[model samples]
Target: MLLATINSSIVLISLPAIFRGIHLDPLEPGNVSYLLWMIMGFLVVSAVLVVLLGRLGDIYGRVRMYNLGFLVFALSSVLLSVDPFDQGAGAMWLIVLRVVQGVGGAMIFANSAAILTDAFPAHQRGMALGINNVAAVAGSFLGLVIGGLVAEWDWRAVFWISVPIAIAGTVWGYRSLHELGSRRTSSMDWWGNLTFAVGLTALLVAITYGIQPYGDHATGWTNPWVVAGLVGGIGLLIAFVLVEQRVEDPMFSMHLFAIRPFAAGNLASLLAATSRGGLQFMLIIWLQGIWLPLHGYDYESTPLWAGIYLLPLTVGFLVAGPVAGRLSDRYGARLFATVGLVLVAGTFIGFLLIPVDFDYWVFALLLLVNGLASGLFAAPNATMIMNSVPADQRGAASGMRGTFMNSGSALSIGLFFSLMVAGLASSLPGSLRSGLTAQGVPSDVAGQVADLPPVGSLFASFLGYNPIQTLLEPTGTLDSLSADHATTLTGKTFFPQLISGPFHDGLVVVFLAAAVMSLIAAAASALGGAKYVHQED
Candidate 1:
């Protein structure tokens, strides 16, 4: 779980380095697809396959499957580090390998909880799962720090770090981890798995691409392919529901939803995961693009510092998660989960009210509070989810929960990103154009740069690179300008100051949306009633 979560997060902070290593400019209009694929493919694949893999673990043996996951994850990590191609091929190699790694990630995510539940008695499950959950969630934050620090030296080191961890885990798991969980006799639900995978993939891919510019529009929401993907994906999902209802052996037990705690826990998990995912994205961009640069960090160095600055979030999660779970076990999951999400929502509001270039202490405090809230919510909610389902169905329940959470996280990239992009589009063009012209860029050149979608510019900053110099390079205006003007134009603070207002506008939209999501999650969390542990049938 630590390895999976770490790998999942490290890539994010290391993305700019990875792109550079591959000789690919992810900010290029033509290469945005690679950027999206690099980030989204792992998440999408994991979301799509976890349920099926969990069912497989139930039918076969979880330990066997988990061991295989370690093997696969390790092998893929090695491949990821060894890409020989450059440019498009290099990016494709990494993206494809990430999908394979996601396969391994799905296996680990689907079965890890169920295995722990089987190993621990009901009385101890919450504490045990709490520790496990902290490792999973905390690793995400830690990975950012690790990625930033390591990628400063070698981008391949980001992937390489996973190799030794995977090897150790594979050997340890195969040797010591027994199938403490039940191995059932159900046959594979091939049809159900197929439809669900294909359908969900199409829907998410559509959402992913829908944020990109197309047809001279700020977003591709109206593109024909996206439209077909959305519609077709929905139709297939409907078919999947019908098929699951009819199938004697199903990939996911929809009947789990009849259990109020299970249903509510999952709904809350999805909402919270979406908000949490968006929070991570927005925070990184906020720190790298605006805060760090404003504070005198170089564009090329912001990624590392952004991660370092966010350590308070990880520290808060570590401090609160297990303690909350232990308390929840004594009290009830509902109270902790509900209160935690409300805290999260409150923190989001706090973020919304802050200025673009706020004080570090204020930002750090909010991040810590949000992290604590997430910690408080995560363990209790997860415990409730596991405790609500029957023993025989725990694997599927875990898988279903994993699917919901992972899918929500995946979808967040599209949802919040589109919202942010929309917010930026409203004012960024003029802001960018006028800002550039004032800096001695020709009007035509400035206009051309401004017309490009803000997503690329935003990503360039988020990735710790300045697009101002790159954008002007195409205009051939750098040579025409005096050295003083060129230096001033491409200086570290120039782009950050130029885009601060527009970025803040987008941040308000994104952060507010995240707060609403947390509120909804809180409401759903409240619906789970009190703590009631399930007994094996």
Candidate 2:
């Protein structure tokens, strides 16, 4: 489980190096979408399939499916490590393999909780789950450090690093992890599977496309295809719910939600995930784009530095996770879960207080607090949800929990990016116009250039490209500027300096949204009540 968690996070830190290795620019207009998808596609696919796979595990054998997951995950890692193509083709290959990897991940994610629940006695389940849940969250933060280190040395090493660990896990799981749960001889829920998959895939695709520009607008939300996806997918889901109510064996057992703890725990998990998942990316951008650049780090070095600077977050999680889990085992989850969310809300406010280029020590301390808050919430919430389900139903319930969590993460990426980009679009052009006009450029050209879509600028900063070069290259005005003026215009420092005001505006909006969501999550967690259900001995 630890190794799996490690692999999940390690990729995030190594993305810049990975792009360089494939002879691709992460900021190139055509590649920006690919880069975002590559980072997120594995998560999306895993979120969508876990429920189906979990149901399969219940019908077949948990150990059998889990062992197979290790094998598949290992094979995909090898494929990813030895990626043969260069340029766009290589990037495409990586995306495809990543989806395959998600398959393995789904199997593992779907069953790990059920396997643990089967192995641990009821009294010890919280501690065991706490350790497991912490590994998952810890992996997310640790990925930054590992990614930064491995990517700095060699990008392929990041993927290769997973190979040996995966091999060992596969062997160990097969030999030692036994099937302790009963298998149901139920038929597969084909209708439930089809509707759920198609519905979810459509909705996620709509969200993904929503972040890209559509026609003259900065976002694709109004596009016919995107609207269709959103509407059609939702319609299918509505139909799926109706179908599930009638099915003899439904993929998502709707009745499960009738249990207060299970339902409330999942709702809180989704909201918490939505608030937190997208935050990591926003924080990375905040560090890499504004803070690191202003603090003397070159754009090329910002990715690694951002990861390094964020180490305190991982430390906080490590400190809080197991202890919270142990405490929850003795006391009910309501107190810890509610308090943890309150702390998370506090962390968001803390983030709002600091300037983008604030002192590192202060920033790190806030991040540590955030991590601790999240750790406090995670284990107990997960334990509460799993405890409420029947032992045979744990796999499906866990998968459902994962789906909500990962989907919220994916959705958060879209929501935060959209909000930030919209904020950028509103203020960036005017800021750019003023800055360029001050530098003696013509008002007409400056205004025309400023009015260009903000997506390019957002992508430029995101991929560590110099936004000024991209902004100026298309106008053909760079050739006309004197060498000194052109240097000033295209230098690394120019665009970050220009867009800081607008960027901060967008960041505040994102933070506020996250804070509100966290508060809601805290409320929901509290509503889950004090009841704990343990299957009869």
Candidate 3:
């Protein structure tokens, strides 16, 4: 579980190196979509399939499915590590392998808790779950550090590093982990699976594409394909619900929502996850794009430093996760879960107060506080949900839980990026035009260039590329500028300096939106009320 979780997170930190290694600019027009999809496709696929795969575990054996997951995951890691293509082909291969890896991830995610539930008694379940959940959450932040380190040496090393660990985990789990849970002897819920998978895949794909510019607009929301995907996906999901209700053995047990604890816990989890999912990416971009660049770090080195700077956040999570879990085991989960979310909301507010170029110590401390709050919320909330289900339903329940969490993550990515892009769109062009014109660029050229979609700036910042160079290249303006002027324009200092104000303005919107969502999540957590520990009927 630790190894799998770590690998899942490590990719985010390595993205810059990976893009460079593949000789692709993540910020290139039309390329941002691919970059976003590559980063997010693993999560989307995992979210969509977890429920279906979890039901499979219920029918088949959880241990067998989990073991298979390890093998598939390991194989995909090998494929990603040894990717032979360069440029677009390489990016495609990575995305494809990542999707395959998500399949493996779904198996592990769906079964891990059910396996633990089968092994641990009810009283000890909270403690065990807390440890597992903490590892999973911590692994994400840990991935940032590991990815930075490995990617510094070689981008492929990020994927390579996972292989041996996965092999060991596969062997260990196969040898030691036994199937102790009840298995249902029922047919697969084929219709439910098909509808749910297709619907979710379409919706997430739409969201992924919607973050990219389309037909001269700042975003793709108005694109016919995106609109169709969103609408069509929702329709299918609605149909899936109807199918599940009619089916004897459903992929996701609709009746599970009847339990107040399960229903409310899942809702709160979705809300919390939605609020939290895109946060790490946003923070990473903020650090790498604006803060690090301003603080004497080269754009190329920003990715690595961003990871290092954020270490305090991980520290907080490591400190708080197990401790909160243990406390929740003794007391009910409500106090911890509710308080944790409130703290998260406070952290968002704290973020809003910090200037874009604030001191490192202040940013680090705030991140640590945020991590602590997240850790406090994660374990207890998860335990509450898991404990509410029947023994035989644990696999499916875990899958449903994962589906909501991962889907929230996907949705959050879309929402955060959309909001940030919108905010940037409003202010960035004017800033760019003014800044470029001040540097003696022709007003007409600058105006045309500024009018380009703000998604470009977001992607440029994310990829550690100099936006000025990208902007000037197509216009033949770079060749026209004097040596000194061109040098100044393309230099590390100019682009970041130019974009800071507009970026901060955009970030305010994103952060405040996150803060609002976090508040709603806190309210949902409060509504979930006390944790209910279940026994066999």
Candidate 4:
């Protein structure tokens, strides 16, 4: 679980280095798809496949699928490290292999919880799953720190470092683990799988493209292809639900929704995961794009420092997760999970109160509380959801849980980015044009730069590049300016200061939305009822 999540996020912090290593410019017009794919492909594949893979685990053996996952992950990591191509092909190689790695990730995600449930008694499941959930959630943050340190030394090392751990895990898992869960022999739901995959893929792919600029629009939401994808994807998913009802063996057991704990828990899980994922992206941009640079850190070093600074968030999770899980075991998940989400919402409101260039201690304190709130919610939520299902269906339940979480993360990219871009669209161009023209840039050049889609500037900042330099260099605008003007145009303070106001405008929308979602999740958690475990018939 740790390896799967760590691998998922490590690539995010390491992207600038990885693209540089592959001789690709991520901010280029033609190369943006490559950048988006490098980030989204794994997530989409994992989200699409977890349910099917988990069902396979139930049919075959959880340990077998899990061991296989480790092996596949290890091999893909090796392939990723030894890229023999450059430019598009190199990016393609990584993307394709990363998809393969996502398969492994899906396998692990689907079965890890089932395996633990089988190993532990019901009374102990919360504490055991709590520790597991902590590793699962906290590992994403840990990967940031690890990726920053390793990618600075060598981009290839980012993938290479996972090899040894995966290999050791594979061997140990194969030798030491055995199937303890009841196996259900069943036919594969080919039609159900097909619809689910194709439908979910279309929806997620649409989301991937929806954040890009479309003609005169700030985002691709108006693009014909994106619109078709959305409509088509939703249509297919509706068909999938219908098909699952008629199928002899469904990949997703829709009947499980009849269980209150399972249904409400999943609803809460989806919303919470979406909000959490949005928070992660927003924080990275907040730190890397604005706060760090404003505080005198170079763009090149922001990734590392951003991760290091987020340690307080990770610490809060570590401190709260296991304890929450154990307490939930005794007192039931309802109180803990509801209170935690309420705290999460409060923290989001707290974030809305701070300035972009916030005091470090204040920001860190918010991050810590958010982390603690999340940890308090996660294990108990997972325990509640998993415990609600019959023993024979644990694998499918685990997969269903994972699907909501992974899909939420995938959706966050589109949802939050669209919101941010819209906010930027309203203010960024005017700011850019005025900021540039005042610094001696030609009016035409300044206008052209400002006219470019705000997404490019956002991506540049996200990738830890100087947004001003990226925008001005190709236009030859800087070369025509006075030395001081040129220096100020590309300097750290100028762009950060210019964008902060618009960025804050966007953050207000994003964080408020997240807070509302958290409150809704709390309500859903409350509806999950008292700690009642499913009794086998």
Clashing residue pairs found in predicted model 1: none
- TM-score to native of every candidate shown: 0.98, 0.96, 0.97, 0.99
How does model 3 fare in lDDT?
A: 0.84
Write down the lDDT of every candidate, Cα atoms only. Answer: 0.88, 0.84, 0.84, 0.93
* Model 2 Cα lDDT, one tens digit per residue, 390-493: 87788888889888988888889888989998888889988999989877677898998788777677666655656777677777888988888888887666
Best by TM-score: 4
lDDT of 1 by residue, 1-537 (tens): 999999999998899899989888887778989988888999999999888888888888888888899999999999999999999999999999999999999999999988988898776777878888899888888899899989989989999999999999999998899887777788788889889999999999999999798888888999999999999988888999889999999888788888888999999999999999999888888888877877888888888888889888888888888988888788879998999999999999998888888988999999899889988998889899999888878788889989999999898998888889999999999998998888788898889889988877777877888778867887789999988889987887787787888888888898888889889999989999888888764
> Who wins the lDDT comparison?
4
Show the lowest summed lDDT stretch of 10 residues, model 1.
Answer: 120-129
lDDT tens digits by residue: candidate 3, 1-537: 677667877887788789889998777665676688778978998999888788888889888889989999999999998999999999999999999999999999988888888888766777788888878877877887788788889999999988998899899988998889999888888899899999999999999888878887898999999999999999999999999999988888888888877887788888788878767878877887778877778887777777778788878888888888788778867888888888888888888898878887888888989989988888888888888888889899999998998898889888888988888888889889998888878999999999998877677767666668878888998888888888889887788777788877877888888888777777777777675877887
The model with the greater TM-score, 1 or 3, is: 1
Q: How accurate is candidate 4 locally (lDDT)?
A: 0.93
Steric collisions counted per model: 0, 1, 0, 0
Instruction: Single out the weakest 10-residue window by summed lDDT for candidate 4.
Output: 472-481
Residue pairs of candidate 3 with colliding backbone atoms: none
Angstrom error of the Cα, residue 323, model 4: value is: 0.7
